[model samples]
Target: MRPKEFVYHRARDLDHALALLAEHGEEARPISGGQSLVPMMNLRLARPDHLVDVNDLGLDEIREEAGALHVGAMVRHERYLTDPLIRRHLPALLEAVHWIGHPTIRRNGTLGGSLCHADPTAELPAMAVLHGARIVLASTAGRREVAACDFFKGAYMTDVQPGEMLVSVIFPCPQGAHSGAFEELGERLGDFAMGSFGVVLEHEGGVIRRAATVCGGAKMTPIRLPEIEAALQGQTLAGLDAAALGDRVTGLIAPAGDFQVSAEYRRALIGELAGRALQRARDIALNAQP
Candidate 1:
């Protein structure tokens, strides 16, 4: 089905976008890459009366700021996958971007758009949760920053209000002792992951100094396994019993039955993915440090 009408607004800048959003309110929907939104519109899932086109707003700018990396709202997936700054600062994000759809989809998908769309099975949001990323939102009322953990409220839902637009995403730069890894199980190379996990670790004195585990595709929002992090803290990678850790992680997530996999199967794989990702993160952390 085609949309009943298409009212397009091209914003000269982010402030202009905010003005449009405020003026149109719920009738407006921000358009970045249109990779996801267009498909939904064609299926009648979304029927916004106005499209706030941000492609020309220069929201595609990407740079490193102080001790954080700021990626603008329109930064494309292909750009992200090849960005050296992102590779050095947020390797997990780079890896995650490569897993989002295929080359054609990646060329059209935007980082901010993917996060804002809030698909539970998507890669970037899950990795962002593990990295403790922050999202910058704007409206005519001004701007505010929110933690990735609190930003995603439910499936395809976020804390963003009707008149607000996501400006960018900021990720804290990783230190020398820190490293991260992402892994997922999918039926096809570019399909939504059946279960995916992101792990970030900080090592000191041959022990785990800090860790974060973000799991996706098994729940409404990315599941950050703080319990797994707490359980593994201060433990040396060499001394870890992988099997035991897997069993423990299995009990931590509450995955439900979906067409992709049974609840029980997803629950079992969560343990398996968590253990593997943690091990890889530890290895990467150790190799990078010394």
Candidate 2:
């Protein structure tokens, strides 16, 4: 299916894109990568009166500053996966992204577009939450920052208001002795996972100081499990019990059932996945110890 009639405006820069949006108001959609929005448009799920293409806006770049990474809105999935900086500092992201759709999809999909699309089941959103990334949203009025915690509101919903575009995402590099991993259970390779989880751990002297667990495809939004993270802190990896860790995951999440899987089953899967993710993350952390 083809998208309905709409005015296509190729933006020469960020200002032009914002100008188009300010003029069109809520009827306008700023498109980058066109991986997510195009599909919705073609299916008539989205019917914007104006499509502001920001491909030429010069928003593509990856730079490291201070102690974190700044990823351009136009940076594609393949770039993030292949970039040396990303591979070295954000391996968990690459691990998770490899599970998204296919290579061609990743080649064209933009990081900002994925986050703004705000799919509850998407890998990038989970990554943002996992690393406590900050999202930069811009408009003619200027730019404002939103923490990943507040950026995602619900399924396919975000804090992105009309006339605002997600300009970039700021990911803080993992500090201290730490290790992380991303794991998911999918019916087939290149297919959306029934559920996915990203785990990170920081430890010193055999004691955990910090822990994070974020899960995708198991709720209305990519969710971070504070309950689980809290439980793991101050514990030794060798003494960690998988059963107890799994219980916290299942207890904290209330995933809704669908035609393919039941909420109860998803809860069970979350429990099991949490164990596997945490165990792997712990192993990686142990290996990093000098």
Candidate 3:
């Protein structure tokens, strides 16, 4: 199936894109990379009356401002694999990007597109939640920011209102040295994950100072594991029981099943992946110690 007939508008700038969206309202969709939207449109799952192209709007830079990294929404997935800032500051996100679709998809898929698509099993959204990232939205009225944890309302849903566009994402830089890891289980190398986990740990003198954990494919949106994080605080690396911590995740989430796997299977993946991710992150942090 093909998308319904639609008016195509090439936005010359940010204001032009906002105007097009404002005029068309919910009937318009702002497209950057179009990796996700195009497929949905082809399937007739999305039938926007207007296609506002934002490719030239220039939202594709990664910069640091006021202690946070400002990643333009149009930045392609492949960039994360090689970007020095991403590798140096967001290692977990870099690892997660490796699990995204194949080379062709990574070359064209935009960060903003993935977040807006809001697939519960995607890596970027889980990384965003784990890092406490901020999502920036712009429109004719003005610009506003939303927390990543709150930006995602559900699978394939977000807080982006009609006439608004996602401009960039603000990721707070890890302070005082930290190590992170991302783990997932998928049917195939490039397939959507059955379950995934991401963790960032800040430790000192063999003790955990801070921890952030987020799980994917276990909820409508990326679910942050505050319970596990709370348990990790002040825990010594040598004494930590990774398997026990993994078991705790099973009780915290209730994932829905699909044809590929049972709900119970997903729960098991979450528990197993959580432990592996947490232990790997801890090991990285400890190894970095002087």
Candidate 4:
């Protein structure tokens, strides 16, 4: 199905995009890579009367600002996944990007687009939740920063206002040396996962100081399992009890029955995925030590 008639604006830059959004209000939609939005439009799932295209804007740069990494909203998944700086600095993100989609989709999918779309099964949003990433949203009013923990309100929902656009994503640099790993299980290779887990761990003087357990496809939004997180901190990764850990996570994420996987099945897989993800992170961390 073709979308209804709409106006299109090719924004010259950030200011142009902002102006277009402000003028059109909720009737306007921003199109970056068009990977996600195009499909939705084709199905009539989204029927925006105006499209503010930022493809002309030079917002694809990825650079280090102060102590953290700043990725422009237009940056493509392929560029991020292969960037040397991203691999060295935000290893967890690199791990997560691989699970996004196949190479073709990655080439056209922008980071900002994914976060704004907010699919519960998406890997990037789950990564943001795990690492405490910050989102910079802009509008004609001013700019506002929303932490990942508070940005996602529900499945396919976010705190972005009608006239605001997600400008960039900020990832705080690691305070101490850390290792990151991600593991996911899907019905098919490259398909959305039944359950995906991302782990980021920091070790100081050989003792685990902090760890994050970000789970996806288990709820309405990607969630950082606090119950599981509380148990893992300071506990040596090798000493993790799979059975016990499984039970704890099961209670935390009693997945509601969905068409993809049964609640019991999703609950069961979370434990397995969490255990393996933590173990991989530990191995990566241990190997990095001198």
Better of 2 and 3 by lDDT: 3
By summed lDDT, which 10 consecutive residues of candidate 3 come out lowest? Answer: 278-287
Tens-digit lDDT track for model 2 on 41-106? 999999999999888987888899998999999999888777888877777897888887788998
User: Cα-based RMSD of the predictions, in order?
Assistant: 1.4, 1.3, 0.9, 1.5
Give the 10-residue window scoring lowest on summed lDDT in candidate 4.
237-246
Candidates 3 and 4 compared by lDDT, better number: 3
Instruction: Give lDDT tens digits, candidate 4, residues 1-290.
Output: 88778999999988989999999999999999998888889989889999999898877878898888898999999997679878887788898888888889999999899999898889889978888899999999999999998999998899999889999989886668888888888888778788888888887766678877788877889999887777778876556564577567767886776788888898889877877777778788878878
Q: For all candidates, what are the clash counts? A: 0, 0, 0, 0
Candidate 2 clashing pairs?
A: none
**Could you give candidate 1's per-residue lDDT for residues 1-290 as a string of tens digits?**
87658799998888889999999999999998999888889888889999999888877878998888898888888997678898887877776776889999999898878988898889988977878889999999999999999999998899889999988999888765677788888899999788888877777777877877788866899988777789778888667565677688788778887887999999898788877877777777767665
Candidate lDDT values, in order = 0.84, 0.87, 0.92, 0.85
lDDT of 2: 0.87
User: Candidate 1's C-alpha lDDT?
Assistant: 0.84
Give the residue spans of candidate 2 off by over 4 A: none
Instruction: List residue ranges in candidate 4 displaced over 4 A.
Output: 237-243
- For model 2, the run of ten residues with the poorest summed lDDT: 238-247
What's the residue-level lDDT of 261 in candidate 2?
A: 82
Question: How would you encode candidate 3's per-residue C-alpha lDDT over 1-290 as one tens digit per residue?
Answer: 88889999999999999999999999999898888999999999999999999999889999988878999999999999889998888889999998998899999999999999999899999999999999999999999999999999998999999999999999998877788899998998989899999988887788888988999999989989899999999999877788899999999999999989999999998999999988888788878888
